[model samples]
Target chain A: DVKVTQSSRYLVKRTGEKVFLECVQDMDHENMFWYRQDPGLGLRLIYFSYDVKMKEKGDIPEGYSVSREKKERFSLILESASTNQTSMYLCASSLSWGDLEQYFGPGTRLTVT
Target chain B: EDKVVQSPLSLVVHEGDTVTLNCSYEVTNFRSLLWYKQEKKAPTFLFMLTSSGIEKKSGRLSSILDKKELFSILNITATQTGDSAIYLCAVESAGAQKLVFGQGTRLTINP
Candidate 1:
């Protein structure tokens, strides 16, 4: 079975603080993605990595950055957290970049106060 | 910009009923469309449609895509309470490694 795990299920941070959300996949997938889910907005892509050290910006990448230093791990960084940045963060992995089939990890609900 | 739209943002029905969820897309270099069911946690994969007129079935849930029309429909027959969740549709364009998701349709089933 494919397993995608996130570093935290819930988090709280104060404004101006730095936050990091981590995701790891055991399927050795070559594609990983970061998304944020908000009510009435669905899930919007924040960033994605196709290979180690290779990153691409999705539709909404402002105020966020990603790191993929290893094949199994992908990290999303909030340089400075803001109240409006609070959202449910999701991570997904796919076997190939061209494949639309993806497995998502349990989301992290972050509260930025 | 690539766009994915889902009709009837919310629906309420009773158990044993049948329902159809619709997804339409406007994208360049369209590759595939995917459906997912999300509960309180992460969204789980349901089906992937890349070809027109070919139906994908899993138990009571089935889906068919119309590439020529740029739309897809998911049908669930004899729905149960467990089938209640937010249904999401996403599209992938060529060379785009990420999926563009719609707002999702929230479904409720009462016994």
Candidate 2:
């Protein structure tokens, strides 16, 4: 059984504030991803990390950045949060690029007011 | 660009009924197709289909992929109220680490 845990389940922040969402996986997976899910939009990738200090931008990477200083932890950062940034953020990790099964963490619902 | 589309955006069914969800994709360098069940929390893995015509089953839920048609179908038999959830279909492309996801089909099962 793989376990993926997020730092917060819900968060509220004022406009222009900085926000951080953290995710950690116990399976020692090499691939980690960040996605934002919205109604009618599905899950849009924000960012992904293949290895420590290696990051790649997904389809919707604007207004967001990610950090992967260690293999087990991945952090999503909103340099300056805005109301439009409010969304349900999800984190996932997979054993490898070819391994398609991605274990997801309970999402963090962020509210930017 | 890799695109995954799920049909019948939403469906309502009663207990003991059978439901089928459809997913179609147009992806470059196709690798595999996956199914997920999403409730209020995170999405859980259901099945992963790599070859065509091979049905993958787990209890009442089963799925089959069609590589030639670039599509897949998920079927649930004897559906129960607990089976209500958003069914998601995703495709992994070769040489890519991320999976392209569909908008998902929301299923509602009434007791």
Q: What is the interface RMSD of candidate 2, in Å?
A: 0.8
lDDT of 1 by residue, A1-113 (tens): 89999999999999999999999999999999999999888999999999999999989999999999999999999999999999999999999867779999999999999
Question: What clash pairs does model 2 have?
Answer: none
How well does each candidate superpose onto the true structure, as a TM-score?
A: 0.98, 0.98
**Under CAPRI classification, how is model 1 graded?**
high
The window of 10 residues in a row where model 2 chain A has the poorest summed lDDT is A94-103
Chain A structural similarity (TM-score) per candidate?
Answer: 0.99, 0.98
Query: Model 2: how far is A41 from its true place, Å?
Result: 1.0
Two-chain DockQ for each candidate model: 0.85, 0.82
lDDT of 2 by residue, A64-105 (tens): 999999999999999999999999999999998678799999
**RMSD to true structure for each model, in Å:** 0.8, 0.8
**Cα error, candidate 2, residue B108 (Å):** 0.8
lDDT of 2 at B99: 93
